[model samples]
Target: MEKIKTLNFAGYFRNFAPILLLFFITSTGFAFQDDRDFNEYSGEILNNKNGKAISSAYLSLNNSNISTVSNTDGEFSLKVPKDLMDATVTVSVLGFQSKTLPLDFFKVEGTEVRLIENVEELSEVTLYKATNARLLVQDMLAKKDENYLSDESIMTSFYRETIKKGWTNVSLSEAVVKIAKSPYNSSKKDLVSLYKARKSTDYDKLDTIALKLKGGPFNTLFLDMMKYTEYVLRDEMLDSYNFSFDQPTKINDRYMYVVDFKEIDESDPWYYGKLFIDAETSTLVKADYSLNVDDKKKAEMMFVKKKPSGSKVYPTELNYQVDYAQNGDKWHYAYGRAQMEYVVNWKKKIFNSKYKIDSEMVVTNWEKYAGDNWRSENTLIRPNIVMVDDVSGFNDADFWGSSNIIEPEKSIQNAIDKIKRKLD
Candidate 1:
C-alpha cells in the first residue's frame, strides 16, 4: 500500500497515526470536562468586595508548568494530575491581590473564588517641557532593548478567529500554537506552529462566496508597533500624526502615560489610536488603533484577497489592539486582538452582504530557551494555508492536552453541544 502522510494537531507528522478531529465547545460561563478524570477542575474568579467578574486573571498550580487564564466571564478549567492534587493553585491579576487554594476547592459543576483589589497611592505627576509627545515616543523606541525581552523564547499561545454575518456567527476557528519569539534587537520574524487546532462545524452557513483571513498570527504580530516601527511610526511619518498627552493610568500597580495619536493629513489613508507608555520606563506597553478606511476603493485593496467577479466589496472598519505584560524585570507580548468589518455589494448594489472578522491571540506560557531554531518546513505562514477553511470536526474532549488555552465563552459551548447532537 502507498504510504499516507498526515499531520496531527500537535504539530507532528507521523505515519499511520489515527486521524481525529478536534472541536472546542464554548458556552455561557461554563467549562465542561471529562468525568472519567475527576482531577480536571472548573471554577470562576471574582472580586472579593463587589463580586464582579475579574477578567484576564492568571491561574496556575504552584511549582508546576500547567496553567490557564480566566476568560472575560471569569471562568477557567485546569486539569490536575494525581501527584499534584495536594498542591495549591494561585490566582492573580494586574490590579488585584493573589489568591491561593487547594485543588479540592473545585467541584464538578464548578465553584467561585474572589480576589481582593490591590489599591495604591498614585505617584506625583512630573510635567516635562521637552519635545513633549515627540520626545516621549522617541524614548519608547529607544528603550526597547532595556524594557522588552532581550533573548529569544518559546511561547505557547491560543489563537481564535471568528467570522460573523450580521449578528449571527457563521464560522469560528481556534488553535493552540507554539511560537518562537525572537529577541528585541533581532530582524528575524516571530515563528508560529500549530500545536492543536479545531473548527466549528457550522461553516456551511457561511456565504458561498468565502470571506477569508490571510497571514493569521503573522498579521497580529506585525501590529507590534515597537517591533515594526517603520510600518506605522517611522520618523518621517511622525509629522503626519498630531500627538497629544492624555490622562495617566495605572497598570500592574505602575503609572502609565497615555499618548493620543491622530492623523492630521486626511489626504492619504492613515491610522489613529492611543499608546500607553510605562511612565517610569517609557516602554510601549499597549496600543489600541485602527486604520482609517475613508477611501472606499483604497480600503478595499487592503483587505480583499480573492472574491467573485461580480461582487463589489467596501471596507467599513479596521481595528487592532496589542498588549504586553511585565514578567519580572522585562515585559513580553501578552495578548493581541484584531477586528474588521466589510460590506459586499452585488452587481446591482441593491442587495449587500456585511461581514465581521475577528482574531485574538494570548501567550499562555513561555521559556527563555527553545534549544534550536524550528525547522523551516514546520513554520506556519501565509499564502500556503488559511486556518478557517482547513480545520473540521471533533474526536475527543481533551482537545488541548496539558497546554493552556483561553476558556471558551458560554455561548460557544452551548453552540457546540447543539451541533454535536444534530451531527450524531
Candidate 2:
C-alpha cells in the first residue's frame, strides 16, 4: 500500500479555476463549534409530483438567518438550538414552491418534505421589457453594492470534500471554519480560520497515485460571483460571452429572469451556464457554470498541478454551482459546490484509473462582526490552504460530524462505513 503525502494547493491559472483533495484518515469528531446550542433536524427534501429526491434545496429557520442545503441524495440536516424549536423551517429551491412547517412537525426518524414545481410563466410585457440578456446581467452586476451586504460580518460555515478512485472511495475531508467576510462592494478578500476539520482515507484502496485539493474552503468562497466579479465576469471578459434568455420563472414568489450564457470566443472557450436573476432588484441569486474542457490540453493546465513523472492526468469535467440567500433587500453567499472529474493513466500500466473529487461549503449562521469578540486559535488566512488532519494535529473536541451538513450520497456513506469497519 502507498502512503498519502502532505501537499500544498498550487493554483496559478492560465485560464482561471480549480476541488478535490485526495485524503485518507478517519477523523470522526463533531467539529460544529458554530457557537449555537444546535439540535440537528434531519430530513429528505423531495419533489411532490415525481417523488424524486430534490438536490440543492434551501432550508432556513423562519425569522432567523440559520439555513442549509439538501444534499445530492435530497437529504438535509438543520441544526436548530432549543430556543428555536418553536420556529418554522422553510424549504425552497429554484423551480419549486417553498414549503414551511413548524419544528414540531418534523420527526427525528427523518421527515419527508416535498415541494411542487412552480410553473408560473412570465407575462409578455416582462419578457419584452428585458430583451437583452447581456444588458440585464450588466445591470445586475452593477448594483452589487445595493443588492449584497455592505458591512463586514462573521460567518460560521461547514465544508466537506470527498475523493474517489474508480468506483471506490479513498479519501474524505470536512471542516467548519470561521470567516471574516468582507464587504461586498470592496475588493478585500475574505479571511478564514479553521475552527475544526477531520479526514479519513482508505489507503489500501489506492494502488499508487493520490490526489489533493488545494485551497479547500477558501477557493469555494470565491464562487460567490456577485461578490467576486473578477473571478467570473471581469469587464473585459464579458464581451467574449454570448447571453440569451431562457424560460422565465419565480423563486420565493420573486419575479426572476433566467438567462443562459456561454463563451462565444472559442479561443478561450472557458464556461457555459445559467444565471437566476431577481427581476425586480437585478440581483444575481444563483449561478451554475463549468469550464469547457473539450480541449484536453487546456483542462490539464488548469487542474493537474502535479503528478508522478510517468503518469498522465487530465480533467474530464469540472462543474460549479453557487447559491445566494435573500434577507430583506440584501443577499449573502448561501452555498457553493464544486465537482471535478479526471482520468489518470500510468505509463507502464495498461489499465487507467478514473478519479472524481467533490467539495461543498454552506453558511449555516452569521452575525455582524463585533471586531473585539473575534479571534482564531488556528487561523488559515492565506489564499491557499490544505487541511490535513494528522499534519494539523486535529483534536476531537468541538469537531464537526454528519450534522449541519449535506447528507452524504449513498456511495460516500458506504465509503465512510468501509473505513469505519477497519477502525472498529
Candidate-wise lDDT, in order: 0.67, 0.75
Candidate 2 per-residue lDDT, tens place, 1-424, comes to 5555332223322344444444332322325535556576777988999999999899988888788888889998777777777899888888888888999888775889989998665655354368899999888888998999998997888888878887787888877777888899889888777666667766666666656667778667878888778867876677988999998887776778889999887665378999999888898988988877778776676666777767767877778889999887799999988887888787888998888878899998888887544443334445545556441323332335423666678887786666556555
- lDDT against true structure, model 2: 0.75
What digit string (tens of lDDT, one per residue) describes model 1 on residues 297-370? Answer: 86665555455667667667778887786666788787777777878787866778887777777776777855
In the order shown, the candidates' Cα RMSDs to the true structure are: 8.7, 3.9
Candidate 2 to truth, TM: 0.89
Q: Estimate each model's TM-score.
A: 0.78, 0.89
